[model samples]
Target: MDLLKKKILAEGSVEEGNILKVDSFLNHQLDVAFLNEVGKEFKRLFEDREITKILTLETSGIAIASIAAQYFNVPVVFAKKIATKNLDKATYESDVYSYTKGRTYKIKVSKKYITSDDRILIIDDFLANAQAALGLMDIINKAGATLEGIGIVIEKGFQDGGELLRKQGINLKSLVIVDSLEVGNIKFR
Candidate 1:
């Protein structure tokens, strides 16, 4: 993941409130080639798992999850953050508090997309407070789908997200972790 660490140092910026903004390639504007590499890395990390589908939250997690799904050869299922007219009535849902938005969101995924027999891998652009991941995990549990692992592009190691997941026995892999976000300096773990 040296390449990912390099990309972050070169293109990432530290915003107010400990936010490591990697919008250039990882979030807002995408770099597909780089994402393909990320996908491959995730597959390599979770290669031994029996993954039947990839699950992610909407918005930022969509692109990353979609690319990773290519490597896993599974369909991507995203929880809808905003209510959509086409969403199915029968759904698995959970509430997630957004650190950036400063509010809670009810994310939902159609019941048809997840089931007891499915082995799921969760993917996302970042993991800070683990709120989104927790919500997705709730949905996975509701469907009785087994969560094989979680692949994170960037993790704020200064936060408790990764630690919490690992403590819960989650196989969490983060491409790059920002261990420190001091005013003019940045550190990685």
Candidate 2:
């Protein structure tokens, strides 16, 4: 994950309110090569797990999960933040409060996409407040699906998200953990 760390240092910007904007390569502008490396790392990390499907939130998590799904040979299911006509009425739902957006929103997934017998691996771009992760976990639990593990590209270690998930006995792997973002200085753990 050294390449990812280096890329973060080179292109990531610490914005106001401690938000680390990685739009240059991660969420906004796509970095296929770097993302391929990310996929490889995630596959290596969760290779031993019985992962039947990859779960993620919509928008930012879509690309990472899609690329990683290739390595796992599983379908990627993303929770939709916006309700659509195509989405089934019978869905697993959860509420997530976005610290960055400063509001709570409901995320939903069709029941047909997930089942009780499947083992799910959650993937996302970042882990900060754990709200999104917890929300996704709730959906997985509602479906009676087993959560095999969580793969995060970058974790804000200064926050309690990673610690809380770990305390809950989740097998969480973060490629690069930022211990501090004080005064716009990025400190990694």
Candidate 3:
């Protein structure tokens, strides 16, 4: 976690609205070594959980979750943000509001990927409003799957997302927690 915190200080940028732009290493421009470290840490955090699958959103969450899945020995199932012609019609759906994009989207996952017997671990690059996390939880609930835990790369602790999930009794873990991101300064907790 110290390594991740250092990476944030070294490369992360503070954007307006409490956003920490970690595009250089996290959300974009891929960092294989750092991702491996993230995977190992996630494995360590959820070592005792019965993780059968790793669930994430498409695009940004895919690479992170896929890399981490190597440690969990679980299949990665990413919910698609965009609907494609080839996508299965039978799916678990949820609506998500993207504060970054300033729009709402319907995320979907094929019903075949998750089942009642599986324990799912949700992973993502960031957690701010918890909309995406909530959306994923909806899908998992629809499938009757037990949520093992949530593993976040960078969490804006100033936001209510993490606390809200914890209050709901779902196991949530974030690697790097940002306490504040204002006026080009990144503060971590």
Worst 10 residues of 2 by lDDT: 180-189
Stretches of model 3 off by over 4 angstroms after superposition: none
Task: Write one digit per residue (lDDT tens) for candidate 2, span 84-167.
Answer: 999999999999999889999899999999999989999999999899999999999999999999999999999999999999
| TM-score against native, each model | 0.98, 0.98, 0.98
Model 3 TM: 0.98
Q: Native-vs-model 2 lDDT?
A: 0.95
Ordered from best to worst TM-score, the candidate numbers read 2, 1, 3
Candidate 3 lDDT trough over 10 residues, lowest sum: 12-21
**All models, RMSD in angstroms:** 0.8, 0.8, 0.8
Write the number of the candidate with greater lDDT, choosing between 2 and 3.
Answer: 2
Model 1 lDDT tens row, 82-101: 98899999999899999999
> Candidate 2, TM-score vs. the true structure?
0.98
